[model samples]
Target: MSQIRLYDTTLRDGTQAEDISFLVADKVRIAEMLDDLGIHYIEGGWPGSNPKDIAFFKEIRNISLKQAKIAAFGSTRRARVKPEDDDNIRTLIQAEPDTITIFGKSWDFHVREALRISLEQNLELINDSLVYLKQHVGEVIYDAEHFFDGYKANPAYALQTLKAAADADVDCIVLCDTNGGSLPFEIADIIDDVRKHISTPLGIHAHNDSECAVANSLTAVEHGAVHVQGTINGFGERCGNANLCSIAPALTLKMNRPCMTEDQLRQLRIASRTVYELANLVPNKHQPYVGNSAFAHKGGVHVSAIQRHPETYEHIRPEKVGNLTRVLVSDLSGRSNILAKAEQFNIDLDSKDPVTQEILETIKNLENQGFQFEGAEASFELMMRRALGTLRHFFSVLGFRVIDTKRHGDDNPLSEATIQVKVGGKIEHTAAEGRGPVNALDHALRKALEKFYPQLKQMKLLDYKVRVLPAGRGTASITRVLIESGDKNSRWGTVGVSDNIIDASYQALIDAIQYKLVQDYAADKKE
Candidate 1:
């Protein structure tokens, strides 16, 4: 197999996903990241569509990309308009990209119903647009929109469309599964047949409506397609486009087709996460290859086997894609799970020790009470350290009180919190006001502790989530709270459970503070 070209459409088709939008600066940063990852082509947005896209094209030109060729996307000329006269075609040249990619109607149904043009007129549109772009741009790619459906509807006309692009001397012709409804067998069969007629290099662009975008792209490659187009994290309209995160690895590791260097492949998770962060969206932890849970082992049997040999459970090494294997502790965990987690935290433990068994039983009981430790490893670590008599007592909470008052004509209630804590026999009491009860409590706690531990001032509560366990009981349900806290250096998660929401929040907040202090104490001891 030849080296497959990796083309990224995250900036163009990815933005079509619902609730996904990026600033111009975000696009530039993503482009630079993609280039660093060894992408062959980076498709910027259609310059004629929106001002933001136009600005992205303008901003990206100033940045020096390492390896990728920037391509501007647009549609072919309208039904009878000359290619030079069409605004969309003109904007592609104005964007000043190294390459131009234009999509033309390939399905007879789309040409007749969508474009409302005759069959011969559509052919003329494809030929005229590509021929004109080839004259101005150094490279031009032709995307056959709905190519699979078009081939199924009228194979002769689909071949004719490719013939038009081929005669224009385009760089590569990409077949798009625009509706994302085709299966792998159909994709393989169609590409097999298309290869017999078109001499130009072929590419595959798939969408995930039927949840086969990744499979379809792989199938096409197996059948001799050279170029693969997809978005990072599979961001696109409706079901999303093919995920390059999965495709890139499958090609390099499984198919024996080298699309990127091993080092560049290691940055896969970082690139996937960076795009999600810029989009302001929570990442799908279940996503393949780059997700947090991708290599995590939960069952005791699986954990034991993986500890002996990672290949027993993992398809490939997690570090190959910048991910790590994690052992989660819960009611289902056994001695092996405890040992593995101890190894991860760099805490020495013997599996035969009775304390290990005791800790395991405590975790099972806690999980039975709805205290989950999968996402709150910090809390679990502190518990283990306390059981082992290795944890330090930074401070003890004496008590805390929060009050909310509402009066007539007041749109919002006033919240205040009073906190008392004892640090090494010194009592500190403080009061603070905030927008809400939780915020007030946080402020009061910090104020009381900052005098002794000034480092606490650098910590911020990044996220807080509450889940009511065994729902339908309404106010009587047990509430589980998870708090994410971060300083300038790192972040950690702590969890708490209680019937009272305030008490649950307080428990989680206490764990967060204690974990930070413990980390600082350990660093000081090492020094």
Candidate 2:
């Protein structure tokens, strides 16, 4: 089988995305993660661009990488400057990376319009920079920026650019769709034409402007390119770059090419989520392979089909990408869907059981009332337990009160909450203050429950989300709150809905605490 190299530019190109910035530590962490994923090249950053990147290079030198070669990214020498005299080239050498990737203008339009340099000078810069880097670096990869658009406009000049890099003995010539506007057919044809002119190993770096970055990269590989350049989760400037998370599996499982080992491929989901976590961005749950909803089935027909033969609905096993198949319960679900869900929960429920039909009706009714259980599996499970007459009593809420007061000249209002709860036949009353009414209520409730169940300290609210359901009554619309709660070992989401926001938040919070106690109760029974 042919081997295609996975080159990750998350630390460099991926960070160019708006609202996506990483600290020096985050950069090093992601680099190590990429190496563990068995990537061929990990572009650390553009060392000469900023102090943060330079610090990254300095810091990364101390850590040892196993599989990937650390690369420093830069541009060709400036107009009319010798390669040896350019500060950018000199700084790249100082970084002392295993590979040096320098991008040179491949389009005649960019040479004249962007760089304001004659075509001949641009070619000399490309040749001189690659040759100079090759002398100091173990391997040098030349990035032909905007090569596809350039070729479409002036084929001769584009070919001339690749020829210059090939003559310089660069290890590989990477064709870049910088604008990301090229179609898959154009990429395939252009790569074929470039191969006819030069014998150099070819690579692809595509953007997602036209939403074809992954398609373009695959097309290039199908044609002749052996190296794929992309970012995790497709993050980059504008629309983003080609997503290696998508590209890796396609090359390995579908195309019969080896990009990473099976073991490394299994780590793709964790690595993808880690990058999004470090960037403080929400993971895209609907992403191609590794997303939470990737192999999830909601419709009755799809669920029944998948239960019989997963291949009927899924292209690949979810476990292959570190994700698992999910059978979501909704109004559209059928008896088969209920049975499948029951099987996942280890509950014994037959398809013909009256409770199964009752649960289905309940789900449809609750959904009509603005209660979505799709993302709140804990609440759904709790409902099942109650319907099955297996729910254990943890605590019972007696009453609760919240007060918000604003003093003269104080812009912020002080929120205070008092709660009374009965835990194991004893009533506990507690009060607390917080920045907001919801926080105050949470503090007060947890305070009342802590003395009875000390394990409450181990659990805390991770996230709280609120949504207003559409209603003709406008401001009187019902509100729904989803609370994400976590203990040290795991996290679960619970939801509640009410006309009052505070009431909705309180309901969700109660569910969260009850869920934790139920887990403790189960653990105790197991012991």
Candidate 3:
């Protein structure tokens, strides 16, 4: 099988996504994980674009990478300036990377309109910039800006642009679908034409404006693309860039080519989630292979068929990409789903028993109460485990109170929360102040428990979301809160519901802390 080079731009273009940005520390963490995943090329950042990216390159040098070469990205040398004197070129060289990628216009329209340069001069720029980059780096890749559109407009000139990079001895000529509107067949035809025109190794870089980035990229690979450039999670400008999460698996498993090895395939989901988490964005629940719902079954017939033959509905096993399969219980669930879900909770469910009827009725009631078991599987599992007597809840709250006050000049209000609780024949009292009344409640709850469970220190609330049901909008209100918490090795999600928003927040907070303690206690006993 061929080993197509996989180039990841999750740190560069991926961070540019609107309302999504990464800290330098998070970028380093992602880069190290990608290196461990065996990606051939990781475009760390455009060191010349911003100070944060530059700092990332500096800090990454201290870490040891096993198999990935970090590439510094930049545009070609500035017009009417020598490559040696150009700041962009100098920054790329100063980054001290093994490979440098530069993009220059190949479309005549862009040359005339965007760059305001003659077509022949644009050709010289493409060749000269690549030739100059080759002198400073072991590998130089020339990205033919708008190569697909250029091919449709001036096929001869576009072919000449590739030839220029070839004569200049660029290691790879990556045909970019810059505007990202080309169809798959069109991309395939362009790839075939470009491959026939140049003897040099070919690469493909696709964007997602047409929502066909993955298809177009794979089509290019089917034709003759030996290298693929994409950002993890499809993050980039506008619609986004080609997603490496989908592409890597397609090449390695579907196409029978080894863009990444089997081990790398295992880390694909982890890499995708890491990027999403660092960008402070909620992960797409249906993002191809790595999403939470990728292999989930909710309907009666689908779940039953999946139980008989997973291949009937599942293209690939969820566990293959570091994710778990879910047998979702909804209004459409049948006895098979109930049994499967019960078995997952270590319960032997008998459809003939009244208890089974009771469980299904409870699910129906909770679903009516706006409890979505599909996204809140943890809550469902907890219910199933409780019904089966497998769950051992640590303790229950006897009472709690908050003394919160607002100051005139201070922006933050003065808040203090105290918890009075009795657990296992012992009473524990604790007081703590927090950023807000809700925060004060959380801090005091955790503080009281920390005395008994030291494992609470490792549990950090990664995310919190709240919603007020429209039906309960009057004096009485029903609120729901979801808490997603993480530790060193595991991430768990829990949900809470109550009439009072404070009560709902407290419920989730309790679950968040207890879940961590349970996991740590379980791990210790196993050891």
Candidate 4:
């Protein structure tokens, strides 16, 4: 089997995305993560462009990487300047990365319009830049910027650019679909033609403008390209770059190309999520291979089929990518969905038990009344435990009141919540102020219960979302509240529904607290 080199450009090209900007420390952490994922090259940002990237290259030298070589990215030397005289080239060498990757104009139009340089001048820039960098850096890579579009417009000139890099004896020549508009067939044909003129090893850098980045990348590998460049989760400028999260698994499991070991492949999901979390961005649940819903089954028929054979609906096992098959419960759920979920929760539930039917009926009815359990599995689990008569009451809510007052001159409203709760034989009343009614209620509830169960202090409400159901019009519509809560160990979701938004929020809040107490109680018993 042929080995494919995986080059990750998340620190450099990925930050060009509008939604992504990493601190110097964030870049180092992600580079370490990429090294752990068995990537061959990690492209640190351009040292000449930003101070943050320069700091990153300096800080990263302190940490020991296992196998991945850090590559610094920049453009070729300026048109009229010598390679040794260019500030960009000087800074790249000072960064002291193991490898240096510099891009030059491949398209004749860009040569004339973008760079305002003669065609031959651009060739000299590419050749001289690599020759100079090769003396300072251990290895050098040449990125043929806009190579696909350049090849399509002027194939002769595009091949000449690769020839210049080859003449410099650069380590590799990467053809870039910079505009990201090239099709897979076009990439295959262009690469096939380029191989006739250039004997250098080839790599691919693709963007997702036309949604063909992943397909084009794989097609390049199929056509004999040995190196692949992409960002995690396809994050980049405009439409983004090819997603290594999807590409790595495809190369390993589907194409018989081994870019990483099986154990490293299992960290694909973790790597994808870690980048998203560090960037303070939400993970795309529908993203391929590493997404939350990649192997999720919701329909009754699909769940039933997957229960017998998962391959019926799934292309590959989720565990291969560090993700697991998830059975979501909803109005469309069948006995198989319930049984699958019961097994997931480690609940001993019999398929034929009357309680099973009762839980199924309750789910369907509640869903009809503006409740969604797919995002609130903690609430679903609590409901199941209640039906089995195994759930312990942590605390009971006696009453709660929220007051929102807006002064005539003040723009901000003052919200206060007073709540009373009884824990066994003791009753506690508390009042708290917050930015909103829900916040005040949450504070008051915690104040009332933290004395009884101090472990509740560790739990935090992470996210809160409210959706208005179509059951009624405008202000009369029913609302559903989904609350995401987490401690240091794990996170879970709970939901509630009611006509009044505050009442619905209260229901979800109560479930969130009860779920945490139950988890603590179970942990204590196990200990």
Runs in model 3 lying further than 4 Å from the true structure: 23-25, 51-63, 348-353, 402-419, 428-433, 451-454, 472-477, 486-489, 513-527
Please state the error at residue 356 of candidate 1 in Å.
0.4
User: What's the lDDT for candidate 1?
Assistant: 0.94
Q: Estimate each model's TM-score.
A: 0.99, 0.98, 0.90, 0.99
Worst 10 residues of 4 by lDDT: 468-477
| Per-residue lDDT value at 335 in model 1 | 92
**CA error at residue 254 for candidate 3, angstroms:** 1.0
Candidate 1 positional error at 397, Å: 0.4
Q: Model 4, stretches more than 4 Å misplaced? A: none
- How do the residues 233-343 of candidate 4 rate in per-residue lDDT, one tens digit apiece? 999999999999999999999999989999999999999999999999989999999999999999989999998999999999999999999999999999989999999
Superposed model 2: Cα runs more than 4 Å off: none
Please report how far candidate 1 places residue 16 from its true position, in Å: 0.7
* Alpha carbon deviation, residue 120, candidate 3 (Å): 1.3
Task: Judge candidate 3 against the unseen true structure and give its global Cα lDDT, from 0 to 1.
Answer: 0.84
Evaluate residue 161 in candidate 1 and report its C-alpha lDDT on the 0 to 100 scale.
Answer: 98
lDDT of each: 0.94, 0.92, 0.84, 0.94
**Model 2 clashing residue pairs (backbone):** none
Tens-digit lDDT string for candidate 3 (97-142): 8789888888888889998988888878777888888877899988
Per residue, candidate 1 scores C-alpha lDDT tens digits across 400-500 of 99999987675799999999999998999899998889899999999999999999999999999999999678899999999999999988999999998
